[model samples]
Target: MTGKTHIVGGIAASLAYAQIGNHDPLIMLGAGIIGALLPDICHGGSKIGRKLPLLSKLINMLFGHRTLTHSLLFLVIVAWLLNSFIPNEAVKAGILAGMVSHYLLDMATKNGIKLLFPIQMTVRFPLTTKTGSKVESIVFSLLTLVSFYYGFESLGYYL
Candidate 1:
């Protein structure tokens, strides 16, 4: 997915986490952003993509695009890895929230995500916006709107 889609997915995922429980907004947003782009680490030229070529390529070869790395299982593993460093429930939640949102947004695209991964099940929405579609811009704009609203609404008084 593109950056805009990732941002939209991040916002939506963070919002979902906020709705579920009380936590720090910044932390949640951070996680969402990380998750949005985590899967693309296999793009062969991304920051992480370049660092872990073998792992990324292996994942890509085994699952194909938007498959294993986009699944709930993938999210959980990422959460576990993050928890090791953060060692906080809130942070772990944020990481998972972001990854799930990433996967969901991919599902909304034309190619869609193979959410079931190794199972070979393809999950897609009825209407896809196409990769790099205008929906990316519109969705990202809305995400920014929400972020500004909540970012300040929640953080302003504290600051």
Candidate 2:
């Protein structure tokens, strides 16, 4: 999935999380976006990857794409780190929501991610699509609408 799609998924997840958790929509959205792009750090062409070219290259070379960074272990470690370092529950939840969204989106791709890394297990959905394909674009658009609707709905509660 593209970064934009991940971002939309993250926002949608944030909105969904906001419905059940006590958090500011804006903060959740911001954290969610960051989390969504975090997993793609191994791909040099990704949004976050482009920003840190050297780190991205190193990760890509050392681990390859969709390996350690996209694994459940990575998510667990990240969650642990966030829990230990961040005092805000809502913030941690929002970030985790985004990361989970990232994983789900990648799971829909043809080349599924090694969700359980070091175990050589790939978790994928029944239906899959190619990355950056027209189908993904449609998914991106639909998720955008969903995100907008939910985002507005979520904001109404705080407003």
Candidate 3:
């Protein structure tokens, strides 16, 4: 999935989570955006990679794309770090939700992701689509609709 798709997915996931958890939607929105782009830091061409070139380069050099950063181990480490550093429970939950959404979206792509890392095991949905393809666009659209639904619902705008 592209950066835009990931962003929308994050928004949708975060808003849904916030609504379910009775947390603040606005705060989650920002954290979700950050988390969605976090794993892509391994690819120099990705949005987060472009923003943090030095860190992206170093991570890419050390772990390569969809390796360590995309792994469950990375999520565990992030959870630990967030628990230790971030006092806001909503922010931590939102970020983790967004990252999970990112993983799910990427898993739908043909290239797949190394969910286990170090183990060299790739994980993906049974049916995968090409990044930036029409199918991905459809997924993006669905996520957009979901985002709008959750966004409005959170604000007390039911429809």
Q: List the residue pairs that clash in candidate 3.
A: none
The Cα RMSD in angstroms, rounded to one decimal, for candidate 3 relative to the true structure is 1.8
Question: 1 or 3, which is superior by TM-score?
Answer: 3
List model 2 lDDT by residue over 33-109, tens digit each. 88899999999999999999999999999989998989999999999999999998778888888999999999999
Where is model 3 more than 4 Å wrong at Cα? 157-159
Better of 2 and 3 by lDDT: 3
How many residue pairs of model 2 clash at the backbone?
A: 0
Cα TM-score of candidate 3 = 0.97
lDDT of 3 by residue, 1-159 (tens): 999999999999999999988878989888898889899999999999999999999999999999899999999999999999999988998899889999999999988999998999899999999999999999999999999999988886232
Residue 81 shift from truth in candidate 1, angstroms: 3.9
TM-score of each: 0.82, 0.94, 0.97
Evaluate candidate 1 by giving its C-alpha RMSD to the native, one decimal.
2.5
Stronger candidate by TM-score (1 vs 2): 2
TM-score-sorted candidate list, best first = 3, 2, 1
lDDT of 1 by residue, 1-159 (tens): 576667667766775676467777777777767766787765666545677899878877866667778777787777778867877666677667777777777787888876776777788889778766788677777767876776665564356
TM-score of 2: 0.94
